[model samples]
Target chain A: MSGLLAVESAGALTTVQDRGRAGLAHLGVPRAGPLDRPAATLANRLVGNDPAAALLEVTWGGLALTSDTGVWIAVTGAPTPVEVAGAGRGSGRAEWLPAGGRLRLGTPVTGVRSYVAVAGGIDVEPVLGSRSTDTLAWVGPPRVQDGALLPVGAPHAPPAPLDTPRPPRPGALRVVPGPRADWFADGALDRLCAASYVVGEESNRVGLRLDGDPPERVRAEELPSEGMVLGAVQVPPGGQPVVLLADHPPTGGYPVLAVVHQDDLWQCAQLRPGDPVGFARLRGA
Target chain B: MDVLDLRAFGPAAVLAEVADSAAARSLAAYARAARVDAEEVVPGARTVLFDGVRDVDGLARRLADWTPDGGPERGPLVEVPVVYDGADLHDVAARWGTDVDGVVARHGEIEFVSAFCGFAPGFAYLAGLPEEHAVPRLDTPRGRVPAGSVGLAGSWCGVYPTASPGGWRLLGRTELTLWDPARYDPALLAPGTRVRFVPV
Candidate 1:
């Protein structure tokens, strides 16, 4: 049966997200999706939702909701204290929430984001074939707000067995030289790999502003704006590198020195402000 | 036909570096016409990015073999009615060594082509202004450039799809709705669409 979720507290920042709109960059649309793809996918799987189903992305946890129907739900991503009907429940497992049961998530202790997946997924109207909220372009569904009534779709299949293990900790991000690597000085990529950078406070879904020794540029002339891709490490005139994310603008003028491997980008979603990050060059790149 | 420098952009995409924005547009058109196996074929100032490729090697080989004869095929013409009363009209006149009337006449005469879209949704970078008449951006960007404000920066012409902070030299304004998400084709001036700024 279908259900409804009453938002009691929207937490720090919560938004609906799905796979996101693809192939629309020509019109300047950003591909806004869950930053932690694997975690979101696992949450969907645990709740028996389709991979393309829309779910909630909670930033720094603290989301509180009340379900109007008994449904299966799962929480993944950053480890947080999950409680249902005042009973503490473990994170990363499917849990039953009876009708009128209240679900609350405490602040995450380690990661920056958490994914909450219900059995049938969030039933918001899709825009451009996605439910993800693009902070850069402000596309897709609106951000979750307190006192909002969210419609839940009918259950598709029974909830998966509650035995999925949490994903292992990510290692150093792997990188390869980008198309505009020549714009930077010699050994710039090596220098980028050598230095340890911290996530800047201004970081958002658009990009991860990194604080570290800026990479020196060989070319002083303004580079014409070019198509930017996800995971691109674009170095601005200030020398600091900003790793473009899912909501990054379609094109940019700065030179890109390196690109983080797609498989490793999920680690960026969990990194909190001041989290130290390191990079490693791909073998033979 | 022009040879393009191809570079690998991450594992799933390829960036074809071209000489100029026109070449980038042409290459993007060529890729789309050839049905290149990619999720998105985006044209930029001097590059065409083929993203989400299933077979990167095969797509790269196909791109290498392409020899475009000329510019991209032009789309339908879009006539924009401009008021020619922007705040920077006198400033642009001083830069062009012409009077305000002269500037308006010259701008209305030229036929511009939508080269690509960026900076924001439905914001097309319209090209076609001659190199010598290129205009410089303002020393300081305005805090807010109203939606439909037609402006120029370095030879590239654009109309703000929505109210935003901009650095382009404002030439005039239009009433056309540049972006509407509910519309079938949200961007009124998509890439390759021919544009003409008719003085109102």
Candidate 2:
């Protein structure tokens, strides 16, 4: 009858996420929510939950859940081999789990994250019009810990046995040149469009630190600190690019080289460590 | 401030630059100029956001080509009570080659304006930290900076809305909650909101 599934095993970096808190960046709040927005939305729709309902965002894929009351739920994204009471969950799949039946999420197969949505939705106190967890500035609580009983609220409508799996990530990401695109040398734009960068080991929710050819700066003047956006790719002194993620800071000093298109944000979120990333030009229709 | 050219940020957002002493003043100007029909008008340390469902390109082009009415001289001053006791206070002064009083005076002299919001909710990027007062961030960032903590690094200053790990030197704390989600305006200080700090 409740909305939230109890946290039996809260894997690394698992947090409650929804559509994300926007329009508050002027107040210094970065939009922190599910890295894979489409997947979260799909999972929500499958369980007959609201589009903005909060679900568990499991990164590096390791989580387990059990319900106090029997509920219908669905698992999607990253092709995780989900098991409910010893049954497997595939892409675009829905299954019913009885009360106290264990729901487990194994390791990531294709992508790096997975979303598990309940029939109702997780009912946690929302901060700033959002139930999404922001760990960088303590805006929300840290990753869910073991033995934490999440309160599952009632669904807006009865559970639907519908199957709506998210579309697979596109092959390439369309990125727009940065506001400071002129800061780079003549060939910098070509290099950005030509090079294949890898997600470095030092990446996190705050930002994705990339490892690749260091681009030359055309205008190296010390820039005044300014506001940054989620998915803004800024290159530090070393020339490596740092892709700003959902939990990025309110402002930064580095020069932005490019910004990943909002549509491809899920692909950027699913990029595992050492994954190759090649930037493509964004063309308006 | 003169109206500059507009640039498209993304599918739903458009932005314009106001390369001035303080981005707050111009941001406020833009906010007032587009007062109506804007889904959201967000200002930051050095940028302003016009996000929503309208004609993003048309609005951006209009913003780039139109002149502003020079809105209120950006005069919403918020006096923050500080204790002047940050963990990195003493060291920051030394790096800037200034005495404690000198640092305090510089910190209070000019009114700081909200330029942008980014890292965390309610984290205001306060502009107007004098160039001389600016110092490089700590080599290794501090593990935690408490709520309402004032910090300075590089060319900007900021107040930690919540307890967060930061690299900026902390000089003091305040009782005022910069950000409380339950409130109508969660972040106490918003872009163009003047910040006037007074020692406790």
Candidate 3:
């Protein structure tokens, strides 16, 4: 049976997200999806939802919701406080909430974003084949707001067993040498890997802006706009590297020094402001 | 049919530099038609980026002998009606060494093709303008240019798909929705589509 949930108090930034819209970059559409794919997938699996099913991606939690019908749900990513109907309930495991029962998620003790997956998933209407709210282009459904009513699709898959928490690995993010590495001065890649960078406060879904020694460039002229891929580490005029994320622009004019490995992108998503980050080069695939 | 260079963008994608924008567009069109294993066949100023490449070696071989198919000829003619009332209308006319009416006449006479879409969703970079008509961008961009605001920069013309900061030289405004997520086709001006600006 279909279910409905009402948002009581939306968090600092909450939006519906799924696997994201693809094959539309040529049309200038950003690939808007869950920043943490593994966490989102785990949350969906715990609740017996499709891996690509839409869910609530809460940033810095404060989300409170009550379903009209009993539903199965799970919260994953950035271990946070989760309570069901006033009782403390742990996250990362499927839990049943009786009809009229509320689910509240408190601020994360550490991480930056969290995922909440319902059995049937967030059934908001899909745009461009995804329900993900693109914070940059303002594409897809509107952001979840206080008192907003969310539709839940009928459950499909069976719930899976709770697996061990897979926290983001610590240490340096891995990188592959660039499509535009020549634009930088000699030893630029070495310099980038040698120095530690702090996550800038201005970072968002578009990119993770960094505060560190700006990589010096040999090319001073403006580079004509070129296609940018996810994980592209583009160095703007300021010299600081900005790692392109899920909602980054499809094309950019700045030269890319390197690209972070896709597997390590989750760490970039979870990095909080002021967190230190280092890059490690991965050669010859 | 000559390929200038092929450089690895990352582990998966490659940027193939070609002769010109037309060649880049042709390559992108051919790749999409041939169902290349790449996820995105994106055309830029003078290069095409084949992203999410599944068979890098296979693609490399295909690109080695890639011949330019006359250029993209998909999609229908999209007429954009403009009011010719923009913040930089006079500035654009001044740069063109022409009066407001002359500028409108010159802009309306050309048939522009959607060379690429970037900067913002649904913002297609329309090409076909002669080199003599090239215009410069604003020294300082406006914080927000409303959606449907038509503008020109360098040798390209485009309409802002959504309200955002831009530095293009404004020429007019169109009422048509350049992008609509609710529609079956979100982007009104997909690449290769023919576009005409009508002065209303």
Candidate 4:
């Protein structure tokens, strides 16, 4: 189905996102894709949308929308209450929303981000080959606003059969020692793995700022700005480590102590402020 | 030919350490020109980061086999007109041990290279200032630096592409549009572009 999805309420923060703009970091452009990759991928699969098709990355839920045509929709990540025409519908599976049906979402129960996928993806104009919004650089399509009419693309294949969602893995996040690990004090890596850090309130798409014992530094000289990467555990002079995310700056001056394993990075997207987290050294990294 | 010290950045990338910023720029330029099998070839102050390489070991071996001989290709020259009335112009003059006019003349004479882009979109780290003329950053960063404000920190010069907090010592303001998303190439100063500051 292809039509328009009118936004009734855009919630706290909502933006159109897809696979994101890669190969542009050299120009200082951030790769602004969905923070929770697996969730977004699942949402698209459930609705039969192309893997790279754009979707809504709804933060803290509360998004309300109405469609002009019947369409298959699916919600994934941080299980939240979904309603269509004032009737309750289950998340993590495709559900048909009739024409003129009002669809609404409640606050998520656990995670901080939620993904909403329509049979046809959100067809916003792509910048640098993606529809994802880079909050840091203000690149790509504008943020989804209330009363905005978002065009939906033509649907492809039929929705996938409903499957049980995989349970979240439990344990400390795995990390590999960064190149600048020598900039920190002796045993700094051990200290970093030992301490439990709480997510700071200042956290956003750019990074997850942690509040805990700052890793001690041995070097006093300032580090010249260097290229940064996704999941870099950069520690500022203040000592708190900020785990770089999808929208992090292309370069930074802080010393990176470790890089979180790519597979474990999605967990950071769902972590709420004040949530306790810990890290462990990845063996044979 | 100097060898690069390659270090593991993460699972998908490798950090190649170079001798200095000049070598870093050269390495990045060579990698791009050679069409290195990587998603991004990024240049920093003293490192070139190759990210999204499927086979890190193979890429490292290939990189080791090559040498960064010639410097980056001299890109098209872009002349930027400036109004030399920045907030820190006097401070910079005092530090350079010259009058305001002398500072302007010295800055205008050098042809700077766009070393790399960082800090903000379209903001290029122009390298040309001699080591003796290096300037220190402001003790405290300004809350908002106007767009098109040309500033110097240490041995590098840059134009603020957008209004944001910054600590670089302002030398002047340029009327040129540094960044525009609608343009075919958003950044006015891509890496390797040669630039000259002309006093208008």
Where does model 4 sit among the CAPRI classes?
medium
How much RMSD separates candidate 2 from the native structure?
A: 3.2
Superior by TM-score: candidate 2 or candidate 3: 3
Model 4 over residues A10-124: C-alpha lDDT tens digits?
9999999999999888888998899989889999999998889899999999999999987889999988999988899988999898899998999998888999999989998
Shift in Å, residue B94, candidate 2: 7.6
Q: Write the per-residue lDDT of candidate 3 for residues B105-191, one digit (tens) a residue.
A: 999999998888998889999998899889888899999999899999999999998899999988889999999877777889988
Query: Which tens-of-lDDT digit does each residue in B1-200 have in candidate 4?
Result: 25698888888888898887778888888788878889998888888889999999888877876676565456789999999999999999999999999999999999998888898888999998999999999999999999999999999999999999999999899999998877888889988789999999
TM-score of chain B of 4: 0.95
The C-alpha stretches of model 4 lying farther than 4 A from their native spots are: B70-73
Q: What is the TM-score of chain A in candidate 1?
A: 0.97
- Scanning candidate 2 chain B in windows of ten residues, the lowest lDDT window is B65-74
DockQ for model 1? 0.82
Give the lDDT of residue A54 in candidate 1. Answer: 92
The local distance difference test score of each candidate is 0.90, 0.75, 0.89, 0.90
C-alpha lDDT (0 to 100) for residue A20 of candidate 3: 92
- Candidate 2 stretches greater than 4 Å from native: A1-4, A162-170, A283-285, B21-24, B36-40, B61-74, B85-110, B128-143, B154-157, B165-170
Candidate 3: share of reference interface contacts reproduced: 0.78
